[model samples]
Structures are given as C-alpha cells and as structure tokens.
Target: MYLVYYSVEISNLSENKQLSCFMHLQVPQTPTVIPQELNSATSTSIAVYWAVNDGDAIDCFQVYCMEELQASKDAGALVEEYRVTVKESHCILEDLEPDRCYSVWVMAVNGTGCSLPSEKAIFKTAPAIPTINAEDCTVCWDTATVRWHTSSASAESFTLEYCRQHSPEGEGLRSFAGIKRPELKVSLEPNVNYFFYLRTVNPFGTSEQSEAALISTKGTRFHLLSDTAHPALQISSKATVIHLPEKTKFTGFPSVLGELLPARGCHYWEIIVSACRSYRIGICYEAISQSSVLGLSDTSWCMRCCPTQTSSLYRFLHTGVMSDVCVTEHPARIGILLDYSGGRLLFFNAERGLVLFSIRHKFTDAAHPAFALEKAGVLTLRTGMELPEFVKHS
Candidate 1:
C-alpha cells in the first residue's frame, strides 16, 4: 500500500522561526449505513442520506442497490442494479420497482481509493396507491373495529372512510391523526353489511385509494328462551328489547327474561338501560325459584339499579341477599361474562368501565340472561361492541 502525507506549516513568534510538520492520515473508511427516508419512497424512487464522521476527507460516495429475493418463486426477477456515485452526502435512486424490496449499501471514496461497503439498508418502494387485504378487521354489534396492513410501510398516516350499505356515503369514519398502527373504531348498523376503504399520506404525497373492505355487524340476535317474563311486560317482536308497564306490578321481580342457555364456554353479552328508570340485569339457572324478584332466588345472579324511587341505589343480588354498589348513571350498559368451567360470573358497568361486582359459584346447570324493570322505560339488548368509557360512541 502507498502512503499519502498531509503537511501543516507553523510559525513560532517568540523564536522568530518557521517550521513544517508532515502527518499521515488513513483513507476514507466504510461509511455508516445510509439512513432511508421510507416515507419519501415512491413506485420508482427512494431517498437515502449518510452522515460524515470519518477522520479523513471523503471525495465522493457510491450507493449500490439490488432487488431482494422474495419468498417462493425463482430469484430471476430482472432487478435493474443501481451504482450511483455522488459528491453530496445523499442520493435519490430512480427507476425502482413498485412494492419491491431492495437491499442498499454505500461506500466512501477518497484519494486512497474506495472504502469497504456499508451495512445493508433494506426498504421497499411504495405502490401508486395504498392497498389493504383487510385481514384482521372485525365487526361486533353496532360498532366495528377495523384494522389493516399496507403493501408498503412508507405511509405516515392513514385516512379511513366507512359507511353502512344503506346509509349515504361518507357518514361515520372519524379523523385519526397517526398511521403507525392503522386501526379505527366506528359506529355501524347491526345485522347489516357495511363498506370501508383506506388511504395513506406522507410528506411526499397521498397514495392511491385502497380497495373497499366489506363487513357486517352482529346486531341484537338473542331470543327469549324462558317464559319467565311477566304477562304484563311488553316484549319486542325481535325478542331483544323489553318494556315495563307504566305502573310495574312488582318492584324488584323480573320484568323480562331471556332464553340464553349457556352450557359451556365463557359467554359474554350486554344490555343497555339508557332510557330505563330502574333495572336488574343478570343470569340465572333454570331451577331458580319464581318469586317477587329474581334476586330473591338463590339460583339467580344479578346487578340491580333502582333509579325511580327516593332511594335509588345500585345493588348486586344473589342467594336471597343484596349488596350495595354505586349509583347507576344514564347511558349505563351492563356487561356480563359467565365462565362456566371457571365457576365465576363477572359483571361490568360498560358506561364507567368499572367492575362493579363478581360472583363465584359452582353452577349446577345451564344459565340464562334475566332482566327486571321497574317503572316505565325500555331495556334493549346491546349486541354491539362494548366500548370503553373513554370512547364517546353513541
């Protein structure tokens, strides 16, 4: 190897003498891995930048790129190789294939010749438009939790648009700022199909629109399995909503009952008492005694809220006993999770996200959802996504 030297001339003022010193410096070594601007990548180009940190001066840089071998299929994808030499610290490679991943590296060159290649930087060119297969998207009750993955991760943010099939276009999707995790929660129609789409945007530009995603929400679909509802109580034709008479014949007894016979598995469901003056919602076994109220039966489990009377309080009822809970609020929905094999019944205040109470019991047989309404109001079986209290989903 040949050695190159650098000389510096210095003057000693006190001694009135001039001296020169010669020093040998190493050639520009390998450059650090180039930083890629993934968000700026397009179907045909990508921008990469590097920082200068070597002790020696850099004459120029050469950026090398090649297409990555994809899984399956042969490795004969005629990838046009790129060998760009530039005096600047950055370069924008052109004529790249869309949606194709590529391996890139850079080397620094100076008077001593070129340095070793840098660590490879992997990236993919974004498509003209965002694309989604809508793999993990789900619809529950009157709300749907939508999720998807883009063909390229270059997108900085996403715009989701969704609406039920029967409604006019552009009705429900809310504004979400970041696209890091591409997820959206929106209201939908129960038992009805809906359509949705997605688009990605970055500093470069907005990508093309994603294909329309289609799904259906699980609407109120439970039926009354037992004839325990009082003859006076008005049950809806769908068997999901119930109404108590203006003057309730019984104060704490069941106003309506459902036929959900859960033999196994952790069952989950909810009921909305937004318009009710008072309600007692829970699950009960078939052998539960028919009495003044469901709570008085040893075989029944329930959470009660009496809002109409002077002393309207929230209570948990089981085994002919009552325990005081918190005062109930409007828009209050009750969610019940009964783990038969686990021998536990968990109750939640959907409006507050509070675990009001949980009961552990060895269930003897199958159980069903039960309701007791006091005064005039409607209790609708909520067959939608049980939302957290933080979400303002009407």
Candidate 2:
C-alpha cells in the first residue's frame, strides 16, 4: 500500500534521463582525407575519398589501409593493416598490392563511437604486368638471357620488348627502356626466332604487355631457295643474293638451293664472292640432280673456287672425287661450318682465318645449302652465323 511512496525520486529521474540521452549522442566529426583518386588508381585497385565530417552522426564508413614500406630496412617491421566497411563517401580498396605505396585513412562509424582518423592519404598502385620467365630463358649463339616477374613492388622501370619471329609488322621491333633489372642481356640473331615481352614502368603507370616469350636463338637459319634456283641462277629478293649474269647459260646445273639443314645442331654460314671464275660452296641431298654436277653427286659436298692467274685453286669435291687443297690465301669470305650431329663439314677462309676444306660424311639425308656459279660471279649469302672461336677450337 505504499504506491504513494512513488513520490518517485527514481534516482533523480534516472539522472535526468541520462542527461537527455547524452545530448543527442555525438561522435562523428573528423573526416577529410581525399587525394588519391588519380583517375581511380588501379593495378589491383585503390580509390578512396572523404569529406563528410558529421553527416548526421555518420553510421557507416571505415577504410584504413597501410603498406608504404618499400624497405627502409623493412620499415617498422613491414607495416600492413588494411580494413574497409563503407556505406558511401567513396571506397574501392580491393585486393591491392601492385607497385604499392598506400597509406589512406577515414573513419566515421556511429552507434556512438569511432571518428578521429582522417588525415593520411598518399597512394601509388599501378605497375604489375611483368611475367615472362619463359622457362627462365637462356639461349646463346648470339646471346639472350631474359627473365621477368612482378607482383609489383611498384616496379620503377623495365621494358624489354623484342621481335623477329618472322618480323615485318613493325619490322624487327626491339626495345629496351630504362630497365632496372628483372634480368636481361639480349643481342641475339644467330638462328633467330625471338618474340619476348614485359612492360611495367611506374611513377604510377605503364603496365600492360607481358605474356609473349618465345625465344629461339642458337644456330642454323636458312635462306636461298628461289624456287630451287638454276634458271641461270639469280635468286635475291632477299633470298640472300646469288647472281650469275654475264650471259646466263646453264644447260641444267648451275645449281642453287638452301633452306633445310637442321636435323641436329652446330651450323654457321657465309659466302661472298664476286670476281670469280668457277665456284661451288656446298652441302646437298635435297634429292640432288637437276642434271647434277655440284661435287659430281653422291648427294653433294663441296668447296671448289678455281681462279689461278696465280691466286685461287682449292678443291675438295665428293663422289666424283677430287682433293687438291693447299691454299695460303685467296678467299673472298667463304666460311660454312655445319656439324649436323657431328659428321662435320668445314671450309672457312672467312677473311683469312684460313682452313678451306674438311668433310667427314655420315649424314643420312635432309640437307640443302648448295650453289654453283661456274662463270660470271656474285654470290652473297651470309645467314645468321656464330660458331667461331676458330670454329669452336677447330
């Protein structure tokens, strides 16, 4: 019966209604960030913005991020962080990490809490695209080393690029650019076949190429085949030159052939004679016989030249037998190595390193590279070379 005791002082009316609900619950007022949307960043994503400052006591928004540790001796033990939570005021964040440098901030949140962080900002991202370990490349016969990789630490430079896998689209492409190491050596041309790739620059941009890698360089590449020449021989629209004009007369065997010979390795080439009286240079068996005569056939092998007003008479034919070699000097650049699985076949005089003849035989078939001019001269076909440390130590 003391309901009247409810003269209620219920603790001063619950302390005046908890001080009027803490004066309408405050706690949101520090947002301002903004300064990293350089067109929405990218390479993994970033974006972020701010400015709100008390938008009706917020109620959402957090962000945060960090990173920015490009090894200042592993800055503060590799700073990391990251967070998110949005509801607007901008936010993209995403898997990020490419060419990094971040920092960011923001905050806001509400049910009466969070709101003090907002000044940091800074940013970078955008520089991932490397990949090109093309099985770690290596080559050699003219050089090649290549190699690449990048999840991005903001690659500050690197370009590479290449071409020659049938060049002609931007013709022999080639590029190098700043390059800050991810490996590179390049020079290549012996046996060519290239195609490489890899881009990734920075200062926040340039990356979108990597993923090509083909590489071949090692030795052996062919050229002359003007429809298997001999209509008085003339091939040279890039068939690597060969001419015979002094009144072309060939009842059938002024020969010419090339473009095959790589069933194995070790090859080398060159030829450049102009001022001739007889010529032969050799390798054959593409089913020889167009009225046959290069080295008198057994499927060919040669080295003839014959000019003697007192200066050039070398021989070494095959099958029609002939041997006579004993020069001391008389070479207009001839070189030709071919080791096809080691059955050897040499003949250099290439600028007087002198050695003019060698043969061994054992090849079973598929071989080509033959030529014969007999009179009017001019043969010129150099081909990707590389195999001379004196022909690999003789």
Candidate 3:
C-alpha cells in the first residue's frame, strides 16, 4: 500500500482529546473553593458544595467523605470512607453517623482521570436524638424535674417537649428550648398525666424527637360533684366550694361527695371552713345517699365541728357512734390524709399542726370525700396537696 498513513494530519481533535490519545491527558484542576452550608446538614447526612475551575474540562465530580480520626496515628483503624459520583457541583453524602466529625473533599473527574482532592472540608453532623433518663426524672404536685442523656459530644443544646397525656396532639403542648444542660425543670398541673420527650440540636439542625415517656404528677385532685350534692347546696362554678344559704327551704342534709377517690397510695387535701357553727368533713363510700347525714352512716367516717361561743367542740364519728376530741383552739383550715393501702384516715388542724383524730379501718369499698354543713357557712375544698411530713411519719 505505499505508506499512505505517514501524511495524514488530524487538526479537529481538542487538546485534551489529543493528550488522551497520547496517554498524557491532564486531570481537571482541583476545586479551589468549597463552601459548606451548615444549616443544610442533618443528623445522618451532609451537603457539600464546590466550584469547578472554568479553564478545565470536567465530565463528572467525585466526592470523598470519611469519619475524622481523633488521633492521627490510628487513622486507619477507626476511619470510615465514603465516595460518590455526581454530574453537578453539589452532593449530599447520606447515611452518615449522627453527631460525628467528618472530613470531606471533592475532585473534578473526566474521561482521563480524577483531579487531586480539594482541600479537606471539615464539619460535624447534627446531634442525635437524646434519651430521657427515666430513673432521674422526678415529679411533684406542680412541677417536674426531668433529666436526659446523649451520646453526642457535639450536642450544642437541648429541647424538652411536654403535654398533658389526655390532651389532643399539639394541644397544650409546650417546649423548653436552648437548654444548655441535659436537665430541665417544668411547671405543670398537679395530679395530671403528662407525656415528655427530648431533642438535641447543633449548628446544623435539630434531631428527631426521642421516644416519649409518660408520668403522672403526685397528689390528689378532685372537685365536689354537683350531681351528688343536696338540692339546697350552692356549689361554685368550679365545684371546688359549696355554700349553704342562710335561708333555703331544702329539708335534707346539705351534703355532697367529691368527684374522685384514691384507691391506692396515700393522698391528702385541705378544707377551709368560714366561720361555721356546725359541719361534718370526712370520707364515705361513694354509694352513700346524699340525704344521709355524713358520719351518721356505717359507710362514713368524719370529724364533726360544732363551735360554741366559748370554744369549738370536735367529735370523731362513725356508724352513729361518736367520741369527743379535745382541742385547744378553733381550726379554720383542716387537712385530711387517707392512706388506702395502710388503712389509715387522719384529720389535722392544718394551721396548728395538731392531729384532730385518726381511724384505722380496712376500706372494703371505694370511698369519696364527703362534706355536710348543718348550719349556714362556706366550705372551700382544696385538693392537689402534698402530704405533710408529719402525716407520713405518723
């Protein structure tokens, strides 16, 4: 054939393609500027952004990410490597560990080869969800102290969320944010069941909500049942107080029963008596008739106060039998303590810290707090009270 291949010249090929033909194609220039949007990062993913050099030809981009080593010497043991290929200038590295430091770099790639990796971009993913330390959480009548723990060393802050357990979702849900420590104290309603959870936050974003925990605040909470009250008894709108008008034609005892009862655990409440001449405050079986005088039936026990001009006379009564109790002063405030498991009932002069009377009886039936006003007076009920230390010891 006469050596015709010697004279042919190809000028249409680009410099890079020519270099590739000669096996000397230059790699794309390394990405010079990589800007990290910290807010775009999440617990398990990170977004990386870089700029491609305008003068170099690029086909695809390669992203390399790895967990940063705490010690340089042990880099090979603990490091986890991740790589991805993309046609765009940005990529989201997925399935990364939460709350961990990572080093990332980008390389412009072409048919020839990949460029050197860009300067390492170091960042930390958002913190992981926190766990509520149930054993460390404590609740009282009106407040709760909650504690939590996290595995994330990068946790910047914490948030606590709570709501009444019975309330609808998002209703009455409250949050405490920007808590630097893993603990928080929240004010809450007494004797209410509440649901709680925790979340961790970093500069990147907030973690997912932790598993929820349920707790009930301590103390007894109840109100007078209007349906169980005598017709003449004037019950307050909130049903926390009852009044017997000085003039009324009702014939039966002005009595009422509390709306709730404690079948277990020790419970306490208070009653404010406003200048009453005669009244009966006690606990009785819920089946007790509203017309029956409190303390006069076998199902009830009470402390009856009948004050004379000279002094206040008190008596402990049950099943129509009564015993006189000596008192040094009139009591305007009375405290009632009932320990169902212990089978103990006690009445206290709340202001004087004097034990007015006590009875030990195995409660065979569900008991409701009962009140009766023999004469015109106001009786305000106060529930959700913590048991006194003296009562606990007694």
Candidate 4:
C-alpha cells in the first residue's frame, strides 16, 4: 500500500546567515548482506531465515513474497508483504499456494528509513488438502460461514463446494470456484442440513477434498402480515425488518402484525428489539380490534417494555392492565409462544429464557404475531414462520 504523508517543511534563506540552531538527523546504517534461506516449510506456510548486522539501529523488518513468474521480473501485481518489529530474525509466510515456488525478500526498517532488500530466496511448499474447523463453521437465520486456516502463501485461490447433506447421489454439490478469500459466506435454506468442503488451488494444482463440515440454518423465518402494519411503521420487503422513522407523526396506531395466524398446535417465534423507547410484542386474534392499543383489547395478549427516566424494564399488558413484574436490565430480544388449542400465551426474555409473563386465554379465533413501537425503533424477525395461512385482519 502506498502511504500519504502530511509534512511541513521550513526553508532557510541562503542570503541571511544568522546564527540559529539547526536540527540534524542520523539515518540508520543499512543491514549487511547475508545468505538467505527457507526453513521449516509447510503446505500453508514458509519461513524466511536471515541474519542481522551489528551496530545497526534496526527497528523491524518487512518481508515480501510473491509467486514466481516465467520471466525474471518483479511480480508487482501479486506481491504481498508483511511488516513486523519483533526481535526475531525470521518471519513465517502464511496462506500461500501449495506445491508452488515463491520468491521472497526481507529488508530492515528503522525510524529514519528502510534498508535495501536482501537477495531473493526461493521456496516451494508441500501440497495438502485443507481441513475444516468444525467449531468455526456456523449458521444463523439465513447466513452461513465456513472458516479454515492454511499456510498456502503461494496459492492463487480456493474452491468451495457444498450441498444439502441428505441429498441423493448424482445430485452433486454446488461449486464456487476461484475464491481468493479464506472465509466464505453462503446463503442457505433454513432447517436444512448442509455439507461443505474446500480445496486449495494454485498454478501448480488443486488440493484434495477436505472433510465436509456440517451446519443447519434456523428452521423458521417470520414476516409481517403486510397490510396489517400500521401506517406509521415501515416494513422491509420480506417483512422481517420493521422500522419507525423519526420526524413522523402517527394518525393511527404505531404497530405492525405478522401473518400466518394459526388456529391449532403450539407456535413459537423470536424478535430482536433494538433502539426503542417503548415497544410491545405478543400474539393476538385476527379479529382483534386495531383501533385501540394491543393489550387493552379482549382478544390480544402481549408484553410491553418501556424505558422510564431512571430505569428500563418490561411487563405483561392485557385488558387495560399492566403486570407489576419489573425487569431491571433491558433485554435485546423477546420470544412469544402462542398455543391456541391449549389456551396459552407466553412471553419471555429470548436470551435468558426467563418467562416475563404467561396468560391462559380461551382463544377461539386464529392468532397472529403483534408488535407496537411507541418510539423510533427497529424490530427484526428472528425465527418461526412455518404455517399455512388463510386469514388476514383489516
């Protein structure tokens, strides 16, 4: 990388020879020439070995490495360098191509300036397949990532292949080729098992297939019921994100409701709450009155988290009443569970799993997710959206 410097220079007048103190600078002596060698080489890394000269004010050294080209010239486009100030006389080069030769040069750097580059040292690493770090491979909601470490400093790029783990043979895996980054982010289906494998590629050859890493995306994706959202609220395309803009006034209510109101079985969903003064999240019947606040109606059940002047807390709200329950630390997420057949509605802190409140109601109609944001707020649908929908509230 090229560096930009902002420096102020003062010039002395040649004709005026007034006696004034002049600052002097002493540049460090350049490092002496020495034979350089490659040591302890591996498929993913190469170490450069050299000697330091005496009586030199050396601060650190910069090591530059690049893949060898057919003709002898500077590989300007592909060169990657690492700078370090450690007292050691060697540096390890990582993420290189396997079974490929790399030309490397090391130079000393001090406060004043840098020394001339040392003679080039040639090194070739062994070939080996990359292995997945199962612990580092993870999936959340809709995004999944695969992470691995390799020493192939000479590698041109990598190839990543993946597929649903349960798919049949000949279906084959999906392939993403010529990727230069070590970590890969992939979009995957929710609730599906995925198998991922990697191969290191270079001008020399491709590495063998690595052991497949397994991950599963969240099972459900919740979305707002669309038209049911209050005019004061704004929803994203998928209805997963709800935002309340500032400098706005509400004529109706300030809330939105999610679709897929089910009539039977237990359903659970999570929402991430952020940047709000007060909010309500819970379940309500499709016939619930929208003219009034959510919890003040007969068919709705929800939890309210409001920030007071001195503290932040949450409580259950319903039928013109607020539960006396007080939570000290504010929660970033909330979970709602609606069991229509069992006549149960529950709310809890999503992260700590502490039940904020639960109400048993004989709900006779379809139940939908409800939200109310009294201030500028953002709410994201976390999970739970698998249901057959047939009803919508006006």
Candidate 5:
C-alpha cells in the first residue's frame, strides 16, 4: 500500500475565474528566530526559555552544542547527540571557569519524531567563585557544639551564616565576621540537626550560599537499620533494651495495613538482672515469625526497640509492652529492626509515621533470634524459656 500525506492548501479569493490550487506546498514550523538578551549571572538567577515551533505537540526537549546546530543550519541536530535537559531551567550552574563560551538550545519532540532544533544561542559563563573550605566540626554535645571554616582567598574576608537551606527565605538568621585565619567558629548542639551557610564577601556583595546541605552532629554512636520496603524497619542485632523512664512513648503503631493497634493487647516484658549494673537490655526468642510466635497473633506485628523520649511517640499512637525496663533507663531515641523470613517485617519512624524511612528484611533461617546488646548495655534475657547463650551481668 502506498502512503500519502496531505498538506494544507490555501487559495486567495477574488482572483477572478477560479483560485489556482498549488500542490506540494511547504509549511515551516512557526518561529524562525528567538531573541533573548543575556543578563548578568547572579547567586540565584539563570536563563530559561521554551523553544518549540508550529504548535507541534512535544514529547521531550533537549540541549545540544551550537556548533552541531550551525552544521545543520537548515533544520537542527537530531534528538540523540546532546547533553543535559532544561529539567530545572532556572538551575544555577555554579563553579564555572571564567570567560568561556557556552552554547545552549532546546528541541521539541512529537509523535512524528524529534522536531528541528531551536535557534542556537551562545552565552559565556561567569568566573569561578573564590576558593574556600570550612573546617570540620570539632566538639559536640547532646544539644549543640562550635564549628569553624576558612574564608575564600579571593575575598577580602567572608561572612558566616547558617540555615536549614540556602534560599532568600532560608538565609541565616545570624551572621558572624571572619577576618583572620579565614576562620570563624559557630556554636551548635550535640545531637541537634542544622545547616551551615557560607558566602564570599566582595564589594559586589555576598555570593549565594555555596549550596544548601543538611548536617547532623554526632551526639552518640547509633546503629542504622537499612531496609527500603515501606512500613518495614529493621535494627542491627545489637541494641540494648533499656527501660524507658516512666511517661515514655512510641510514635506510631507498627502495623501491616497502616493502622495502630491497642497497646494493652500487646505483651510487655523487660530484661531481668541478677544485679543492677547492666546497661544493655536482653530478650530470648528462637525467631520472630508472622504466625503465633512471640505471643503475637498478627504475623505483621514484629518487635521494635524504641527510645524513651524520642519523637517516635509522635509517629505511632499505640504503646508497646510496658516492661519495667522502660521505667528505668528511659532512653530517648530507640532503634527498630527485625528479621522476618517466613513472614514480613514492617517498621515505622516518627516523622514519616506509617510511611517513609521504613525498613524490612526477611531471613530464611533463624540463626540468632537472640542478640548481644553491644550498643545499649548488658541485661538478662527475659520472656522465653531456657536462655540460649546467657551472659552474666557484672
């Protein structure tokens, strides 16, 4: 079968006898030229534009070298041979080498295929920002600490500030001077999370904060339970079972279908101690399963280790087993982890609640249902018959 495509035909009226119809009429894409005045680059602004012609439905857009566009000046480069997209057209490309020519263009694509490249445009990138490196944080505490860093050499001096991020709205509420050694130390809390902002000081004013980043101080050594599955949380086999002080709470209900369950329905057990010197808590079990194991009828409900005063209480409304241990140490931040092989394991965090940051891990066999509390402290195993490997508390 032969394929035929019809082009738009136009005839002028009042031409007398009859309007002559021309075949093989060529219709070009709308705009043949795009005009944009290059503006001064700043800490925040960048250039962005839409480059499509003839009202064609676009599939995707691309940016390519202008030289290629000039080589095929008639149309433009094909869809493939390019780099980068206008993903964030307003994205500020930092750390550019001074006085360099950069060419950028956008191409539109449709069902017919990729459209001709847009008009080629060239712009020079600004000079690189002066070099400067901040000092790593030294001292830390439960709440905050002091931090310092060097100023950019090219700058006469630098200004120091910090915020959760680098936006006009996020600009530092506070700023400090850095005139000597290019160093300045700011105070911070031990475990508190924060963001540090740095800028170069020239007569032109402060360059934007290098980049927005999140920084958390090291208050105490904690283990991470890694599992990306939703509503799933896991812990290293080495968390101590300390009694959360009275009034301790957990954030969310560790549920399978995202519902919190009754606290009284769950059993509460604490690690027993021969003496009173154990820092870590311990428990006894062959393996955690989805079935009638660990006295849990719901296979989805697994064991969770929670800190006494942490925000986890805000995530889940239900309470866990209120063992005497919770009345004792009252650890503030607790870690949740599990190994569910025959069944599934679901863990939740306070901020995310029934979602985000949950981890789950499945195991084939129960090698170590019982773990030695390496991080928390030592304790006597409670809740199961016949301790497997009992370690005496001093």
Candidate 6:
C-alpha cells in the first residue's frame, strides 16, 4: 500500500551544527636543562674525568692537550685517542703525569659518529694551592689553629692574621709574622667578628695569604669532635687572581693591603689561596678547579682566591658585586676574632668536583659553629680559628 509516502527521513543535512568532540592536545614541556661541567683529574699517571648527564649512543671522545689547543705550554697537552663508549659516566686517560696540566673534552659519537664537544675542562697536576693538614678554629671565641706544609722544607716560618676582609698586599689584617710553629693558637674577642688568615713565609715574600676565615665571638663553641677527614691538606703556590668584570657593590669593603682592579665583564668564581684555604673573587668558567663542582650553577659567582698562578700586586680586589646593590666605596673592616667549632670551607668549581678544606677544632672547650652564606650569597670567610657573632656588616 502506498501508505503515506511522506517518509520521516531524518536526513543528516546538518553540516556545521554537528556536535563534534575534540581534544585540545598540547606538546609536552621540556625541563630547563643546563649543560653540566665535567669533573676531571689526573690520578697515578692516568687522567680521570667524568661526565654528569650523558645522553644515549655516545660514539667516541676527542682529547686535546694544551699544545693542540694552543694554550700555555705550562698547561701541557690534551689526551688523544681517549675515545670510549658511554657505558658509564666516568672515563679515564691512562699514562698521565702527576705534574702536568691538561685540558680534556668529550664528544658524543652517535650513529653519525662524533658530535661537537660537550664541555671543555682545564686540569693541572701539582695541587691547586698549598694546603694544610689540620686547620680549625672556634667562632665568637678568641683563638685559631693553623697547620701547613712547605714546598720546600726550608719554609722557615708562617704568618697569621685576622681581619674582616681579604688583604691584597702581603700585609693583611692584624698581622702576625714569622711564627716558627706550623700551628698557632691565638686569643680573639667575644664581641667582635673576625676573619682569620695565614701565609707561609720563606726567603721569598710570604706565599699569598690564606683565605679569610669567618668567625664570630660568643657563637658556637668547639669540643673534641670526631675527625672526619685526614689532617694533612696540600698547600701550593699562590693562584692567579681573577678580577670580576662587575664593579664593586656599594656595600663592599676594600682591601687595606692592596688596591682593587678595574671591574669589567666579571662575576665570581672560586680559586684556592692555599690548600686548606680558598678565596672569593670574580672567577670565570675557564678558571674552575678540576676536582669538584660544588656550588656552581648556570648562574655566575665571583671567587677571591684558590690555587692558581695569580700575582700578588694584581691579586687584591677593591670592588664586589653585592645583591641588589653596587659597592663603590669601601666599608670599614672592624670585627672581633674567635675560633670555629666544626665547620668546613666549601668552594664551587665548574670543572672540578666540590673542593673542601677541613679545619680541625682548635678550642679547648666544645666545638663552636660557624655561619656563612649570610651576606649576598658569597663565600664570605675562608680561614679562621673561631666563628664570630654579631657581624658589623656594611
């Protein structure tokens, strides 16, 4: 039957009015990955280096010595044919000298073979700076303990001093000269904060002074704590002084011993003023220790001292980069001296592992505590027997 030919045909004539489901897909966000510096060193006629974050399919490594790199001959040569697979993060260059400087870099040899150099590092044998064995102190209490080794047994005596800032000239804060003993125990104050320093005095003008040790009066006390590390530390020649490119902060204190260099394109890096002592200044990535990378990040930091070949006259810095401030004028250096209880001096390097100097407890009483990183996030103090309280910060 021709029943109502009017078939109710719901024709899908709807073109744009269709209820379409869609997923707003977005790309994944990648983390901010900064290039990490490789830690390298020469051990027992072998050059040992390590990579932090190695990607997949590492093909081979490229080794360049100082000569190939056209660097200083004193810097030595780069290890060649040091190619190896990325089975592990660490790599080694056999048959290296203990008394030579080397620059080693790595390249990821992928399926396409070698890639560009990942990161370049500078390393040298012979300790970075002269270090001491058992160096320690107490804060807020008067007294410091210093021990040292001689490049030559004829090192004669040592010079000790304590001040609030680094001394550019050989003469630094509250100078104590020609002490025949390797260790010195001096009395400090209870109300003033002090920075203790030491230097090896020989026929030559005293080796660069040790980094300033930050201590406070009436802070932490020192008691006989268990010795964690060995007492002996290496001491070396005065390292090259690195001048920060940035001008001194308006709140920074000047060195009474020497004048500051003109600030240019500088920030901060770490260098060893001595074995157990290090200084802060505007160090560059090129001047990092080959042993450790402690506080180094993508951000730049200025270091005053470490083990390098910086001369004395050009060593002192008059300016510094303070947080949110620029120190044009120098501040007064007035602080009390005391012993540190149980604190270690830590330095940041790009190439080296984190370098540390242990100062033995010098107090007859309990061990006192030292507090750093209070100032605009810098290694404020280096060598001290005590930790001071109530710092007269400028």
lDDT of each: 0.68, 0.74, 0.79, 0.69, 0.34, 0.34
List where candidate 2 sits over 4 angstroms from the true fold: 1-67, 73-101, 109-114, 118-194, 198-207, 211-266, 269-336, 339-344, 350-355, 363-394
- For model 1, residues 1-394, the per-residue Cα lDDT tens digits are 3367766667545476666677665567677765566467766777888766747578889999988887754777676677999999888888876666788998988887877888998866665565544335534345556777766555667777766667766566544556556677666655577777777766554455578876666322245543777766777765677887676565335566665444554456688777786778888777666564667677788887866444456778886666786553444577776666677787776766667677888876777678877667888875434333432221
lDDT tens digits by residue: candidate 3, 73-131: 56458565899999988888889888777888888887667788889888778888889
- Candidate 3 matches the true fold with a TM-score of 0.50
TM per model?
0.40, 0.33, 0.50, 0.43, 0.25, 0.24
Clash total of candidate 3: 0
Give per-residue CA lDDT, model 5, range 1-394, as digits (tens).
1122555434555545454443342222422224333434433322445534444444455555322233324674453333555442223333333333445565554444554666666644332233322223322222222333433333545555655433366454576665444445455543345565556554323455554334444322221112210132223243322222233243432111111111111111223432322222212233333222221322222333444453222122112332221223333322222323223222222122222122232333322222222122323322211111111100
Query: Residue 230 CA error for candidate 4 (Å)?
Result: 1.8
Better of 1 and 4 by lDDT: 4
Q: Which of the two candidates, 2 or 4, achieves a greater lDDT against the reference? A: 2
Q: Which digits, one per residue and each the tens of the lDDT, describe model 6 over residues 1-394?
A: 1111222433475764544444232221211112223223322222434543323344344444431333434455544543444443445554544334455565544344444564555554322223543324322234434445545343556776766443357764687786887666666644455566666544422345566555555343232222210122111122122222233353323211111111211111122332222333331222222222222422223323323343211122223322222223222121212222322122232233322221222223221111111112222223322222122110
Best by TM-score: 3
In model 3, which residue pairs have backbone atoms overlapping below 3 Å?
Answer: none
- Sorted by lDDT (best first), the order is 3, 2, 4, 1, 6, 5
Instruction: Write down the RMSD of all candidates, one decimal each.
Output: 18.0, 17.2, 16.2, 20.3, 22.4, 28.6
Error of 1 at 208 (Å): 38
| lDDT tens per residue, model 2, 1-394 | 0011112233566555532221355677788887764435656777777888534557788888887776554545856698978888887787876767788888887776777888898887778777885545545356667877787765777888888878876576679998898888777776777888888777655666877887777544467778878788888776778888997666866778876664456668888885665888888877777678888767888888787786677788888766877564567788888776688888988786667677877777667878888888788877655566777777
Looking at model 6, which ten-residue stretch has the lowest summed lDDT? 257-266
Q: Evaluated with lDDT, which candidate comes out highest?
A: 3
Candidate 4 structure quality by residue, lDDT tens digits, 1-394: 1232434344565554444444433344444333433335556676666776676667787777777763555655565554445456676777875676778777787666777777776776655777776445434445566777676565667889999889987998899998888888787765677788988776545677888887656333346766888888889875678899987888867888876454655566778885666888887777777776888887777787778776676667778676756667777877776766667777766677677777877877766778888888788876633322211110
Query: With candidate 2 superimposed using the best TM-score fit, by how many Å does residue 256's alpha carbon deviate from the native?
Result: 36
What value does the lDDT take at residue 243 in candidate 4? Answer: 90
Best first by TM-score, ranked: 3, 4, 1, 2, 5, 6
**Which prediction has more favorable lDDT, 3 or 4?**
3
